[model samples]
Target: MINMSILKSLGLSINPKLHVTVLTGAGISIESGVPIFRGKGSMWEIPEARRLAMRASPPWNNKETWEFYEWRRKLVSQCKPNAAHYTLVEMENYFENFCLITQNVDGLHIKAGSKRVLELHGNMWKGRCMKCGKIIDLPETPLKTLPPCCECGYPLRPHVVQFGEPIDNKILIEALKASKEAELFLVIGTSGVVSPASQMPILALENGAKVIEINPNPTVLTPYMSLSIRGKAAETLPKLWKSFFTD
Candidate 1:
């Protein structure tokens, strides 16, 4: 069962004067109908995205990967931001200094009206030029055929960092900066088990940020958090925000 007393205390403790940095993961979007890629019975792991992503080999770069990703794009393209997303937006609006760093590539937070967002994993709405370093914008929905670059003729790939790929330095630097400067770090939906992303919460904690974790299940970083609200973000965030600040 969820503890409302803890939630009340957390709300009371928040200092609106301090900067708030939120790090989000795929779990938040699961309620919006996107697949949770890493959790139990995840179908994405069956094909092992890491192998293909490492070299951009067959299946990763081939027609199959394109078809598969197109299906994923179709699903993501149809999804809309849920209550949790709106709650974050409201939080940002209320706070003078607020930063959101998300691990998911679905682009829901941006769609939900977050002004300052650092996509730790690059967005799926964009395409990358394989031949050149240039980025190409693509339709949010899947294209009928492989997309071509404007400057170069090579096939454009999803802008996201697939398994085995490194996170973009620019995004990483921004996240690090936010983590270092944040006085209140909120980790939502993430299990804190996924590599470098998991490390950000710890870095924020080390930098003297008060950490608050929101997840249905206990996570590796739970011990370090100032409060842990065990529930879905969609249900919990809005309640927390509404209880403190009225519309």
Candidate 2:
């Protein structure tokens, strides 16, 4: 359990007028059974999977890429938002100024009823035509082949950012601006290794926001956290929300 004193400190930090920014990652979605793709002993550590998500020239041509994504889509289709996701949604209702920025492409945050969301990574359930750039909502039914565009007759790819592709500049700028303006910042379930997502906590700190980090393990950003709650978000968030709202 996280120290009670830390929770008390966080409660003291909250102000009715302050804007709250929540940064989320794969760990927050793990209760819904989503997998984390990074760090030691992870699935993406496999050379083939890494090559598939990383190397240039359409890794989908490789059976491993196709099979992996197919399985991933299936898993995503079955998963639902867990308690931690809803806790953020509840926070949105209580906090007049709130921004939810997520590294997850699972779409769980939106499904959990978060009204304002900034998806740092693009979504997986949507695809775009390679040739004409038309967005297509992926069918709930899985497809054996890459889905083709109705308009341009070209193959479609997941809207997500692949390993080598750069993040959209407009989204990055918005996330940065949000972090800077927030008076309360929460980093939820992320390992804090991914760049830019990792940069947000520091941005918040420099701008005088109190930083609260909730993760099961110690992370690279642990030392900088004003309050570090050590637990899975599914368990911790509901508890923390209880402390703030029902205590």
Local accuracy by lDDT, each model: 0.78, 0.79
Per-residue lDDT of candidate 1, residues 120-219 (tens digit): 8887777776668677766645575754344667777777887788899988998998998888788999989888889988998899877888898999
Off by over 4 Å in 2: 1-16, 44-67, 150-152
**lDDT, residue 33, candidate 1:** 86
Alpha carbon lDDT at 120, candidate 2: 83
Clashing pairs in 2: none
* 1-247: candidate 2 lDDT, tens digit per residue: 5334444566554446678899999899877887667766565766766665554246333444445566677767888899999999989988888899999988899888998888888877767666676877765647746543435666677777877777879888989998999878999989889998999999999998889899989999999998888898999988877776433
